[model samples]
Target: MDQPWLKALHVAAVLLFAGGLLAQSLAVAAALRNDISPGVLARLRQWDQRVTVPALLTAWAFGIATALDNGWFGAGWLSAKLLLVVALTGLHGLQAGALRRLAFQAGRPPRGLGRAPAAVALALAAIAVLAVAKPF
Candidate 1:
């Protein structure tokens, strides 16, 4: 694929993945406070499985491809962006686990989990800055 097209796809996938993470963060936070119906949770899970996870994978794949094509490996900005991306990916795993536990059992999420949305937003903003500025 052309570089520009690859970049566009990567951007689109990242947007979708970020939106999914935000949605999951809100859903899990809401589940912590009250009783959301299993049916609704099920639907959200379906969306995550069908849309969110795929977007995440696509983002990763295209991102790696773009970096390799451009010889960006070992660059400071890419390294920082990669760290943030890893953190976000791990957060998604936690969110998915929380959703499952909430759907299956009656319990609250771990403390501080409610602040995930803010953390995600902060990390995402930093990632954008690093990617755009490439300041070492």
Candidate 2:
């Protein structure tokens, strides 16, 4: 049996990770609009590198561990959740790369990158609903 505390921790981490991604998306959207201060953009890049990256790694570790412990392989819903997680992970990578370019390169913000966050956000919302409903 999985420890209750471990399950709780995993859920909390998931919420934090998802919420952080949403917040980061909004921040990127804001930055994309109108000229933002160099300091602000630089700080956002730094935060992504220093904080968001680590948090995402930790969240994935915990989430995967919890799923495994809960017999995720036996559940269709769990499999779907894992797939969505992978998609979100890809989006996270794209976001990180975009931030790096925005901070250091003089490029056109990498065309179509802006769509990733919204896509991930929608996927996440669907994932959340699936998790809650477990309608598999």
Candidate 3:
């Protein structure tokens, strides 16, 4: 593929991934607010497993491809953004762990687990802004 088209697709994938995370964060908040039925929670988990996970994986794959194609390196803003992305990925794993634990516990979800989604959302928003502005 042409470099420009590849870059565009990579950016689009990143936007979709970040947007999906934000939507999931909002859904988690809503679930916490209202009484979340088991069926709804289960469906949400299923959606995350089926949709969000694969989208995120694809986004990361495309992002790496773009970076390699473009020779990404030695830029302060890009470095910062990459670090933030790593942090966001770690938070995602943490959130998944929390969800699994909650599912097994068969009790109310831990309130602290809420922080993971919120933090991931904030990080993603920051990454999006930085990507657009590229402020060092």
Say which candidate scores most in TM-score: 1
Cα displacement (Å) at residue 113, model 3:
3.2
Which is the better candidate, 1 or 3, if ranked by lDDT?
A: 1
Q: Which pairs clash inside model 1?
A: none
In order, the Cα lDDT scores of the candidates are 0.91, 0.71, 0.68
List, residue by residue over 29-70, the lDDT tens digit for candidate 3: 554565555565666677778776777788788778777777
TM-score of each: 0.94, 0.82, 0.77
- On lDDT, the leading prediction is 1
lDDT of 3: 0.68
lDDT of 1 by residue, 1-136 (tens): 9999989999999999999999888888778778577788899998899999999999999999999999999999999999999999999999898888887885668867889989999999999999889998
lDDT, candidate 2, 1-136, per-residue tens:
3667666776777776776677666556665764566677777777766766777777777777776776666688878887898888787776766666667755545546557568767898888887778788
Better-scoring candidate (TM-score), 1 or 3: 1
Model with the higher TM-score, candidate 1 or 2:
1
RMSD of each: 1.2, 2.3, 2.6
